[model samples]
Target: MNAPDIIDFGERLLVPHVIKGETQISAEVEHFSRATQETVMTPKLDLDALVWRRHEVGPAFDTPLAEIIDFLDAVSEALDYDKNSYLQEAMEQNARIGTLGARILENCYRDIATFFTREAATAEAVGSFGSLEALDGWHRQSIRGAETDIRAFPPRMVHILAGNAPVVPPITIVRAALSKGLHLLKMPSNDMFTATALLRTMADVGPDHPVTRSFSAAYWRGGDEAVEGHIFRSQYYDKLAVWGGDAAVRHAMKYAAPGFEIISFDPKVSIGLIGKEAHESEESLANVAERAAADVLAFNQDACACARFQFVEGDDEQIDAFCSALQSEMGKNTRYGDGPNGPVPPQEAVEELDMLDMLAPLYHVYGKPNGGGMVIRSSEPVGFNPSGKIINVVQVNELSEALPHVTVATQTVGVYPQSRMGGLRDALSSSGVQRIVRLGNHIGGAFGGLPHDGGWPLHRMMHWVSAEV
Candidate 1:
């Protein structure tokens, strides 16, 4: 059957001008206010046509960096929650995450401004390439009496977006533009609207502009060989920037070769560390519990950097008191306005906790099993992944005991008592943790200066070409 021509672009649903692939198929994708079934006609894979479009549009994005910043400023204003139809549509289609609060949407919008700053971009360019001159044009530098002119060239990139956070699409778009790449984005099934909406906004900035023309966004079943096989070829795309779980990362890795590179933002877990000061006074304990709650419930704990397990150095009574306070804090709305995702925990998660409660003497349960914020106190880390607002509070004699659990997969560690960070930061970094932040701060918010997965992405995304004189 021929698929329907009309496609949902989050806010503005319309018919696509170009289609690829021969097979016509329908997919059940989430839509604003309802679940809708839709059809897609696959246009035949044309590597030459795609490459032509990339070269045609690449020059448009090769403008001055200030122009790009101005374009992004317009996008940021367009994304304002009160006025943005696409964002409104996003809030509706992604009800599972959007319903958490208005502040969540606001925060997503706020993150856009952080990326386009001149200071931030310059710092990233310098940090990654060792000089900003490479960004403007080729720069001459001497090494061991040899002179080389280095220029940062934009590569042809494909971005596989993750839907866990709404801010991802805009961030990806900014990176692609900054690197001046011929970019294609594959939106996740859970979030079909965001990338399209942002791209539409970009087109609105300058219709037929190179930055707009150089971009393409589409969706396909992840492992479909008919589509992936053609696009994943080294001759087609220079880099694959992926953000997903282990399976998705592994799938992309299989396609990596000499000329084709895969930069992956893989699945990671976060935890919180509490020092003995948390038990010294009621005020201190209350502060620690509140901070821990912020880390646990941020983005409904769906963000990889959100803390799922907290290790506390305190007695049973002290730990129990903190848990009681944490339970209360999790249910209450914060300044960011997020609360319990739902009243009930996922059945599988509850079952796992219950079995642990029955089989293990070290496990202690707090709050209701039906959610409203639940906590499990244990002597060691729980065997299963904690989700649905369930936090594993493992009691430790010293915060150092939790270091063994800190692997390369650990993304963020929230520590209490600012001074304690001096002692633990080195050990935690040595253990493979990426970020260390004070408890209560949102772990996912970017200041535009932090390294993602240990490196500056834009620097890595570009091909550093050098000529010897």
Candidate 2:
């Protein structure tokens, strides 16, 4: 017998319970102290009580595949700038609230909602992405030939929101819903209201939109496995999407069942690359580094895609010059997490930064007197050694060594000479790494609808019925 068209979890699911078994928790709020490699909660969160917070928010189940496509059509239409206003007052609102909020903490949902209104509309910037390019090479692989069967399967996913990067989690929600998945979105305590507000707007776009029945949002602590274990074991969800530190992923993984899969976008690292020739413009390195610094400040060096590491090609002087440039660029945003030009508290972040200081082979030192926000590193190291707060500069005689360190989880690596992009394709083509930007413009940049890391998520939570079409 087929399951009901609509399903609801009647009781308020509090404590550590999982709605559909896939678990996405907020590990972004972790305190990276030297004593503990894992992030300690900065939000003063309540994990134990959230297990039972599940209530009847909306319907969740499979919609006909054709209906799914129609919904996508509606979304496409809404994204149309000519017809829809999109993000007019949104960004200005974002600047206002984000600046006033003083920090992008768990408690800033209202401001985040205002910001999303702006940023989401920034799609208006490039025709609201209607004309935007899809990031993955998967589009080429999505074969539309009649020989290939387009089986619309409803996958299950658990979306863990990242408090550090407010707007990012909603993108995952859109991806899963667009693919016709039954999405169980576990809200990060810090930003629950923000996603809730988004879903509310989505409801406006189309009340009976399939996302209504297919998506559920709530918040719980990252490591609470008692509820997650039961939820994952229920075999209700197929994919798990987590965004945060490695420990958070490990904790969520413990609940993974065999048939049920995991889509973990865990703690990833990103960097920048420059050909030696970039040193010619002198200003070129600094110009690019400043843009890259904006990328780091976008989410306060919290997003996996944040360019925490930099790989540059130059003489000692050139590298030093680049460092100076990055410092000057990064100088603008003194505070972190959507706040105004406030002060960034690095006591916890610096601990990890200091520990990595010994492990990292090279880095330029900044801070002290001038205070937080400085790039550290001379050249790209042979391997990865993360510094939480300080920027680790690795002066590489060659770019080849940095290749091993870049992974699917990496979001963007701004490189120079833009043409060399094709040359490194063979060397850097890995499953987890995403895109390669040219020199600067690393912040607020993208090829829309790209699956971060490797396009390897198909293995998770999919109800595949393979056939030779």
Candidate 3:
């Protein structure tokens, strides 16, 4: 059986567990292969730890980006799927799904549900944090220039899924779907489950949901030209949506098919800019620190948008106090895995934190990351390599200076004072960063479908057709 031209994920199902002794997503007619991380049942292959399974041949690539766009235009008109209410719908659905999955997954979905809730609100406020509606608008505008520049080619989209954060995939999935463009989703092996779940949910909502077809999420072992090569060919996807690290994206760019366009959200290095006011009152310090703690636990600070560093505008004493408050906040992260039966994080993360001890005053609180994570620490700056460790505090004279060293992966950087945001927004995007936020809730935000890469538009994902009647 051929895959649907568009899939809702509700009807199409998971494959049966060939392993025989474990729960799995089951279905028949295998034409695609998926990857999973190194599992007890599956041998490890390089860095890809996904469970690979072949599925039925997907519907023809003949649909093309132009046809995809026509479908979106039709859906946009038919469902009156108010391009603006995506966030509200997402929150409602997230809550519904979270409740539904709670008993089965032991409430593993609670955090995800909350993530959707928080991000939805953030997206609505900012125009890009949480909904498909918000993203479609922005993607449309981004493609406008490309539409004018070139006229009959489809977009080659490369989306790099970020494992640091969760549920981020759906935001991209929806945007690409509505843009009516073909999608090349690079699934982060670690967080593939959520996107898979959300896809299932979209199907539950309806098969004709734009998400049903027009997009294909897969794990091609990063640079496996066999998969990416054939798919990213010049005649293939027109835009690329990257959601991983700098190295991941740089490598992805190599496989970028010729004549195809590449639009990406490369690795984002985010920070927290705490104003001296945060330290003015003891209560404020504690309050802000708790907020920092919440941010830390949100996806355990894995997103490029998550705050890896902070520029506290104050003297060492003030900065130290904020650091202490932050440390206090870190101590409260309990979402880590449960008992021995639960998931465990990498020992390498612990080792990395240990290395930080050589530089700064450091400490570690025991907790599991996968399920049982921890708060690893040091007073000095972390080794700077990406691993586990949520908030890093650095005292700064002005928050703006920290922008240069920032990697292109910088997604969301949270600033404390709302008043100073106008100036900082200019500074944040002044470099290659995407969102400059005053509220520190950076981990779970994607609304209003704003230009995700610092006002970068979505029209870049499309090709134009100009004809006179």
The TM-scores, one per candidate, come to 0.87, 0.66, 0.63
Q: Residues 1-469, candidate 3: write the lDDT tens digits.
A: 1122222245332321111112133333232322222221111222211211123222322334334434433332322222313222333333232221112222334333332333333333234223333322213223534432223333435577775444566466545554444455555544434454444434434455433544545443567765565565555444566666678778767765556555666665676776777877999899887666555544445555556666667875676667666765665533421222222345776566556555444443334344322443333345554334445566567766666656556667777877777777766676767776665577444343466666534455555544332
Better of 1 and 2 by TM-score: 1
The 10-residue segment with the lowest total lDDT in model 3: 14-23
Worst 10 residues of 2 by lDDT: 1-10
TM-score of 1: 0.87
* Candidates arranged by lDDT, highest first: 1, 2, 3
TM-score of candidate 3 against the unseen true structure: 0.63
Tens-digit lDDT track for model 1 on 1-469?
Answer: 1113344444433322221211122333322321234432333334444443333447544676556656666666665555666555555545432334446755665555455456655555566666645566677999789999977877788888987777678778877777767887887755666676667666655665556766777766687787788777777788899998898899989989998899999899999999989989899888888899888887677778888899999888888898888888888765443565443677988788778778655777787754468889888998888887889999999999999999999988888887899999989999998888888764645545467777789888988889999
* Residue-by-residue lDDT tens digits, candidate 2, 1-469: 1111111113211111222322233333433222223232322233332322233232323444345434544544443222322122222223232322333433333223332233332332123223322211112223456444333345656777665555565466545554555676676644433454344445546666656546556554556665576565433555577766777678777766776566677677777776787677867666676666766665556666667787777778887887777766665653343322423545765554565456634544655313336667654452434433346677878776678777766667777668777878666766345667675555455423334455534223345543445
